[model samples]
Target: MNVAVSIDARTALLFSPCRLAGLDLRSRIVMAPMTRCMAEDGVPGPATASYYARRAAADVGLIMSEGIGVDHPAALGEGTFGERNMPVLQGAAAIAGWRAVTDAVHAAGGLIFAQLWHQGPLRRPGSGPQPRAVSCRPDGRWGPLDGSTSAPPDYLEAVRPPTVAMTDNDIADVIAAFGRSAAHAQTAGFDGIALHGAHGYLIDSFLWPETNSRVDAWGRTLAARTRFAVAVIEAVRAAAPALPVAFRYSQWKLQDYDARLVDTPDMLAALLAPLVDAGVDLFDVSTRVFHRPAFAGSPLSLAGWTRRLTGVPAIAVGGVGLSRELKDSLMAVVPAEDNVARAVVAIERGEFDLLGVGRALLADPDWARKLRQGAPLPAFSPAAFATLI
Candidate 1:
């Protein structure tokens, strides 16, 4: 049962060199951010450094560290959901810890970026000293703590009403926190910064109209909704003008899976204009499946549309190296091979400038090296997370 699959380096665009915000990537394969839940109360440590360095040594072109919480009380709620004491990016000690990680990644001959984050209403209101939910609904509650055996919600309350709207000050605080975190990231010696604006998180909350119902300045128009992101970008750019800043965005939200940010290309362009104007160096467009067409009558995927619309470098993610959807893969119902063929095809077609490999990379840090060297991809099991560490 021994077979050798030799991947040609030329055909493997995943390994081809590319430029991002003036920084040269040794290859086009990027190690997407995955929460390890291993930080000490939102503080990273030596092990975190080694965890990232391992992937860099294995040939990851770029390392986007797991979302690091910014220096705000709201940011602390993110780690309460059973993540390892994930490190917060504040104060001298935390900054030094991150600097160690940056040094390790660079020493391994890899470029690393810190993914700045703030959870906003995602935090359970009762969980921390000032636990406040994003939407402030009376029925809103935090999920069960890690490893607790809580019964599932009854069908009636399962579909609880929409979240309470956030005030203007709440939004502004989050934006400022993002900028502060980006500055800390630069201080930590990161090669660049990636804003965690995707996945129905706080930034995405403002971007999507459904979650944001405020009639105020931050909620009236697409440009206004984009204000929070623009402000964060301006602050970060001011902090590190030479550093490349990437924004990760998604049309889908955790609250509503079927959410769509724009129904038309014109709307999409309008929404993105402020970000482009703000000097965002790149865009990381996330989708559940990259192969699916983004809009009706368009052959291009969401990432394709983003690049074409903004004319900025874009990274496409979602089921890149796996065959099945992430949920199915996590459930162990199907092998991961189902998605790889399509991803390879997308790479061949230039649907995106970079490929972001997620769980597969977590399953095997050397996934890129193995794929390019034609080695067998390791079996992807949920247990791989435990095994890797």
Candidate 2:
């Protein structure tokens, strides 16, 4: 806040109240979901409640909780590393645990969404709490391991062999698992549901052609590729009819940062049409940079194209209050206020409905409040990944 005079007044726009698909938010600033991998035995404890409540109390609007595994056996696993202590959305203990989290956030005057997740092909077979579960790949491929990837050598070698492609039965079971989890999230008192359909996960695997080479109804062209995600969305809607549903998707994958799902605006529009028809209330378009142009012809960002094409409210994220992308090291320090200024301009131009802030919030629980008060913000550090602080 101690940076530019140009955006002094417009910065207040981020702190203003806005309604997203009828879910009223206290402000336009959303706490983007970040994986913490701290829930023991797939259960969140009181510490989880405290972590979220602190941010809610400081006026961060609409907290999207860390990805909670669905009830599927292949839901949670060691992806890119030893992904231990991840939470799930089933059983009385897990539901009760999440209830406390929702209550705490609500008590602090914040609306929260449960990001239902399934690791898909990213799940290292013979790993996770359920070691016996099979890794569900779309075409029995883990994608090209030679691309620009952040996965380690050992992990790459382990998942190199093609696993069994998802049979019709396997597809049905995973879709059912997402529905069951949505019902549980509603029971736990969450305001809405957010689907982790991005970053080379289950739903995204079907979206990306490189991973999903199937000739069946579940894959092929962009329209056909949407079948899996559409089915998942329909199931969630059926289970929790009243809850708003948001879908998060990205062109880049954990397998390859340079991977892309769509190359042109028309292709992007084609990819998103079925999702809107299937009842997606919001689109969380994940990009490495929020303002970067999604395609060659237009200057519109991915989130911008999503809202324009689908007529659905979209959340724009990535490097919002930081100097670099998610995979880059945060060792170098730079004032993040410049990015916040850019966010104001984008929002004013109606680029996106909500601004998703990740690392900045992790670095400071009072990040939203500090912005509201025009106070200096703490620079993001690598150490922030060490703990739940």
Candidate 3:
């Protein structure tokens, strides 16, 4: 089907209703979780709730909150350079803050999920407690550790490097933290929870060999590396059995940028086996561009491979609504209007289950409503990020 014809017909598969863990989503057009750095001390406030509620009111089926930190010291950090409002989900106050956001979304007739995250090595060194890098090498150290007082240290120096490796006890503690966070999310009125295992964070750190080079039980083979994520999933399931847990995985790392977990199909299956057994209700396969083939000579994209491998519903993200790739448009002062026509066509083709609208939604909270009504979409300006707060 042509873009214009699809847009005209308004028969997008994305608008189709679906059920996840007994929660009925109004449609498949999920508002992808985008970090706006607007949280106050890791606690989302009134502005955050209003920003998300607007989208829900406009018809977003599922709203995944930006990566929220569990109650862990390492997961909490100061704001980055140029980020005046970087938020962290740290203590009891932070948990209560999120409760407000969840309550608001629910009150607005929307289903929302919190994206649990641990910045891992991404925490700028020296800015907070010693940051942990996937690799022990200096280059891999969180950001940089230079003691310069002038000119904010490079991304590396801002974060503290993890001096001590996680022991079995530490691992267990982190798992319990995730469980506690999940339970807190339930109490806060969140409909579901999504584990942020993608983008070279804590969970992905354990999955990659370069970062997780230990010879311990959690570091031998691919199956072994999957141990940490499995623990987390099991813990979350145990804590909130009624809440659907979605696992988000990606091939790329913020450190390496071009990293890949599985170059072959067998390897891919090996990496995913344990996670599947751990009770993940959904798989969110992240890619810079969703249409690209996952492996050579394979018609399947990353999302397709994930669904085929796990037999679970998968959410495909990356450049979904944009006319061009988001990675390329990041520094652009203004982003182009979303091509809902193209997005609808992809949705109809069953490339994946959900369409995650990112910057487009950020620019216009009512983007989905506009599409549903076949109204003209507004241009996406990066300046909207600043004004949204």
Span of 10 residues, lowest total lDDT, candidate 2: 329-338
lDDT against the true structure, each candidate: 0.71, 0.88, 0.72
**lDDT tens per residue, model 2, 1-389:** 23422348788888888877988889888899888888999999999999999999998989999999899888888767666888998999999999999999999999999999999888878888899988889999879865687677787777667899999999999999999999999999999999999999999999999999999998878899999999999999999998999999999988888999999988988999999999999989899899999998789999999988888999999987767777764344444645788778888888888989898898789988888887767677777776886
- C-alpha TM-score for every candidate: 0.87, 0.96, 0.87
Model 1 weakest 10-residue run by lDDT: 143-152
Candidate 3, poorest ten consecutive residues by summed lDDT: 135-144
List where candidate 1 sits over 4 angstroms from the true fold. Answer: 1-6, 78-84, 128-165, 338-345, 386-388
The residue-by-residue lDDT of candidate 1 on 265-350, one tens digit each, is 78889988899999988888888787679899988888888888988988888877666655566547334453455555676776
Ranking by TM-score: 2, 1, 3
Write the residue-wise lDDT of candidate 3 on 150-265 in tens digits.
22446444344555567787678778888988888887778888999987677888887766776888887888899899999999999988899888999886655567877987
lDDT of model 2 at residue 144? 81
